[model samples]
Structures are given as structure tokens and as C-alpha cells.
Target: MITVVLPTRDSAARLVHVLPLLVPAAVDGLVKAVVFADAGSTDATLAIAEDSGARVVQAAGDAGARLSAGCAAARSAWILALGEDLVLPDAWRTPVEAHLAGGGGKPAFIAAPGPLGLAGRPLAVLASGEAVTAAGGFKAGGDPLKALLGRLRPRAVRLRI
Candidate 1:
């Protein structure tokens, strides 16, 4: 099971694309929860997140700080930090389920495809709660995901999505 952490700021439009992808996984019991780390959104971001059954965490700092707060609030043993705009393919759950069933500890990544369905860059972090917490729960400045990746240096799983 995994808790997804999404950092948001007036991201209702983006969430509309990504949240639906997770619903099936949630129903299948693969997604334990979704946590929205909001940075004072004045739009329907909060409402949408709440309506989707995502726990809203009001964080007032940068993305890293908000991510840290979200990670802290996660209740699962695994954490999946996803960018709000990343729309996962329908088959995402299979590889992720395999990763978790393989005794998840090291970090794994899912790359977002480029235009024309070309291979793209890694876009998210999926790892155990301990690994994330040990990495200091994301830095307070700069690219937090990159910072965490640099610290963890996990073997690339290259989850094909």
C-alpha cells in the first residue's frame, strides 16, 4: 500500500487529470491514500481534493516544505510523491504492485513520456516511508525530489508507464 503526496497550488485542472487514474488503484487497495500538500490555494483545489477523499495538508512554504509536511502526514509504509500534472497510464498499478510486492525499500521512479509517446524523464519518487524519512523528508529549498534522489541514489527501476 502507498500514500500519494501531491503538492498543489490552484491545481484543480491538473488534479482532474491525475486523480481519476488513482481511483481504480484505491479500489483495488493498492493506493492507501492521497495527500494534497497545498500552499494556500485560493481556488477549488482544496474542495476538489477533499471531495476526492484526499487529506488536505495546508503548508505555507515552498514545494519542498509542503512535500515534507505531506510526507510527514502519510499513514502508509510506502510513499509515492507525484507531480500534480503527471497523468499515469492505466497499467501503472501493475509495475507498482510488483515493486511493492518485491519488498519495497529502495526508491523507484516512473518516467513521464514526452510528446509523440517518446521515452521521457523520470518524474516521481516511490519508496518506503523509512527511506524518505531517513533522507530528511525533502529539503526546504531547491528541487526537493532531486535532492532526495541524490541522497538515496536508488537503483533505477524505470517503471514503464
Candidate 2:
């Protein structure tokens, strides 16, 4: 049972694009839920998530504190903290899951790199290990989706093969 706890703050556009990629609400009896934390979004972020059947939580004050609130609400043993601006391509999810399941007692945190720009605009980064410290860094171009997709669709980087 993998519960995906997604945190969002005034992320209407990003969430709008990401909500659809999530699949198999309860695959083989494992429940995969997307928990969205809305920290006083003046926009329609809450509305969009609610419409998508996502559990929305509107926390009050401070971005990091709000994210902490979201974490407290997560119901999965392995909650993948995803940014709103991320989406795992159709082909990558299964393989990524397998990779995690077979981590072989290594560091569970596996990153696949991500393009700096959109799916295809000429920007890339290939690295490993975690970049987040104790503090929150939701807007530091540190999105897991980029890393996940980078490996999922490496050709999109277009480094001229």
C-alpha cells in the first residue's frame, strides 16, 4: 500500500496537470492516495484538488509549517513527497516502483534527474542523492517529477546523440 502524499501551495496550474497521472487507487489491495495540502491558496487550488478526489488540507501560516502539516496527514508507509509541478510519465511509474521495492537495502532515495525546462526545451540535470535539508525547498527547481521523468524519457533532454 503506497500512499502518495502530494503537497501544494497556491499550485492550481501544477496540480491541474498532475492529478491525472496517478493511477490504480488501490492496486492489488494497496491504496495509493494523493493528499494535497493547500496553505491558504487564494486561487482555485483547493477547488481543483477537491474535484480530483484528492484529500485537501488548508493549513494556516508559514510554507514549511504547512508542509509539515501535510506530512502529518500522510497515510502511506512510503510517502513520496512530490511537488505540484511534477508528473511521472505513463511508462516510468511501474519501473520506478519496482526499483524502490528492490532497493536492496541501499539508500531508498533514488533520483533519476530532470530537465530544467518543460518536457522539451533544452535543459537537463543528471544526479543522485537527496538535496533537501531540514527546511523546505519546494520552489528550488527541486522537483522529483523532473528526476523521475528525466530517466523515464531521457531522449527528451536532446543532448544530440
Candidate lDDT scores, in order, read 0.81, 0.47
Report the lDDT tens digits of candidate 2 across residue range 16-117: 565555655344434356677666777888787777777877766443444445556766554455544444344445544564465432222323344763
Each candidate structure's count of clashing pairs:
0, 2
lDDT of 1 by residue, 1-161 (tens): 89999988888888888888899899989998999999999899999987999999999887788888999999999988875455566677888888877844568777778789765655678888898877767877876766787787755366666
Candidate with top lDDT is: 1
Top-scoring candidate (TM-score): 1
- TM-score, one value per model: 0.88, 0.57
